[model samples]
Target: MDFEDACDIAEDLQFDLSGEELIDAYRERADAMVPGEPGRAVFLGYLGEFLAMAGRPEETRCLRGGGA
Candidate 1:
């Protein structure tokens, strides 16, 4: 998946997905997605926010490259 596609998926997952579905979206395309460093950071930030909203702060912290 390209950056645009990743962004699209992120946008969808941001509002609608949670738990396993959000995880599945990332796992499905992580190896294939090739967004740049900035893009990757932005995507991760989005994912972190999503995880937080989903009541998964530990996962969000991991996404933020932080320790528990």
Candidate 2:
């Protein structure tokens, strides 16, 4: 599926999605969401989860306090 479709399905298929799909979904989500304080923290957590889902624990490790 395309990035748009991947973004649409990333949530339900989080663990099942691939690297590019997860990355695209990550960017898609960061663009759509990313509020302040609590919401930002939550978004970062989701970002880490997305990286993990993409088999990219390295990227998550580099993210300080889940920051972008």
Candidate 3:
């Protein structure tokens, strides 16, 4: 999906899900995703940023990654 879609979903997730519900929904979507090409990596990056900014009052589900 695109940045706007990701942001919209994040907003929905924040509003509707929490704890196990959030984690399960995240896993369901994540497991069903198609791997993007390298050029499309930026969208994945923006998704985490949007999730962080989406105001999840329960807990943050986004994790961090860095250079090996």
**Candidate 2 has which clashing residue pairs, if any?**
none
- Misplaced by over 4 Å in model 1 are 1-9, 12-19, 26-36
Candidate 2 local Cα displacement, residue 31, angstroms: 8.2
Cα deviation of 46, candidate 2, in Å: 0.4
Report model 2's TM-score to 2 decimal places. Answer: 0.45
Decide which is better by TM-score, 1 or 3.
1
What's the distance in Å from true for residue 28, model 1?
5.1
Q: TM per model?
A: 0.53, 0.45, 0.49
Best by TM-score: 1
- Cα lDDT of model 2 by residue, 7-67, tens digit: 4445654676656765666556555654553434444566778678768887788765453
Error of 1 at 41 (Å): 1.5
Provide the lDDT at 54 for model 1.
Answer: 70
| Candidate 2 whole-model C-alpha lDDT, 0 to 1 | 0.59
Estimate every model's Cα lDDT from 0 to 1.
0.63, 0.59, 0.52
Off by over 4 Å in 2: 1-36, 65-68
Comparing 1 with 3 on lDDT, the higher-scoring candidate is: 1
**Predicted structure 1: lDDT:** 0.63
